[model samples]
Target: MAHQTPDLIVSRRYLRLDCLCLLLLMLSACSSSDQIEQQSRTVASASQTVLMALDAWAAGAAPTAYTVDTLQSIGKTLADTGAQIRSAETSEPTEQASLTKAVNDLSVAVTRAEAGLQADDRLKVQDAQQDLRLASRALATAYAKYFAPKP
Candidate 1:
């Protein structure tokens, strides 16, 4: 049996500690990647919902021909999508906040459109439509900022 020197014992302990740290780092990185992937899927799902609602609204046989019920339904869809976006977890706090704000703005615009439909006010509806377009743009920007491929 050989007696190990103090330096050898210290070196072995240091190597073990280094290995532990590396393992923890790898695990954290994998967790982060999984989180980002989940967030991307959530954003894609919400974006699809918004786009579908927009398409349905635009598919009316005639321009400015959406019924009150249709407007209400679209508004509800927008609100629900916003809720989904809000519930998604993101690695970027700033981007998450921006996306949340954009989604909330879209929901508000849709609500206004629904109100306009209920009031039979074409001007108000048009204004809300414009706001919706802007909100959509903002949301797209935020989504890209957070979910864009890293070079």
Candidate 2:
């Protein structure tokens, strides 16, 4: 067999390099998607916590301080995720849309929870509870549709 020329060897090296670069690119893309999905789950779980708080409040139980605190913590997580989203340079479509939807859903749920806290009326509490549950369900559905692994 003929020995390969130096130019042919150099060319082969670059072709492998090209393949390596492409594989890295694809993996990074997939990782970004996974991050988005994780972020979406955070938002959904936070929304669910808010809903749970509303339920406790409406059931005539003393306001759920733990749940309130959990919701607040989740709010902080969402805010951080928002910053990540704004700073991202990737062109991943699904993750971008997922991040946008998560933020919107969490914002609405938080607003409702804040309103409930501000209200002195029990009826207002009930209304806020209903709103929180509805919003949480919607957010969860969206996340599940886009990112959740199949059961």
Candidate 3:
């Protein structure tokens, strides 16, 4: 067999190194994708919980207009959901910020409604309800935009 040139031996080593690097990069990308998917699923589940709580409150099932306990329960749910959104590990910082803001706003609105219930103020509770609904819609839009599949 002919002797291999020094340059050829170096080129072969470089090719192998490149192949190994490419495989490692591919594996890292897959891991990152899996992490993102898990984060999205967690956010989705929290969003669903908040939405269900909002629906119940809006349907008069919580007696927010009269009972303090129901108002507290709804407020707690909103706050918990907001906390979850804030703590979620999302790849997109801007989207995460917007979602956190929307969720926090809803939580604050619910707290205001709870205060209104405690004070027996119908107008205050109604206004807070409207704010909560608007916040919820904003959050839903953000969630859809962030989690939608790429084209």
Q: TM-score rank, highest first?
A: 2, 3, 1
Query: Per-residue alpha-carbon lDDT of model 1 for 28-70, expressed as tens digits?
Result: 7667556654554554454455445545554653334445555
Task: Residues 1-151, candidate 3: write the lDDT tens digits.
Answer: 3899999999999999999999987777566545544544554454455445545765677655435565566556656656665665546677777777876787677677667767767788778778877876787777677667757
In model 1, which regions exceed 4 Å deviation? 1-66
Worst 10 residues of 3 by lDDT: 39-48
lDDT values, one for every candidate: 0.66, 0.66, 0.66
Span of ten consecutive residues with least summed lDDT in model 2: 86-95
lDDT of 1: 0.66
Prediction 2 TM-score vs. true: 0.72
Where model 3 places Cα greater than 4 Å from the true spot, the runs are 1-66
- Model 3 TM: 0.58
The residue-by-residue lDDT of candidate 2 on 1-151, one tens digit each, is 3899999999999999999999998898788766766766776676676666666766767455654566677667777876665455555556466557657666656665665565555566566666666666665665566564645
Task: Say what the RMSD of model 1 is.
Answer: 5.4
The better-scoring model by TM-score among 1 and 2 is 2
Q: Candidate 2: which stretches are off by over 4 Å?
A: 64-67, 85-95, 121-131, 144-151
Better of 2 and 3 by TM-score: 2
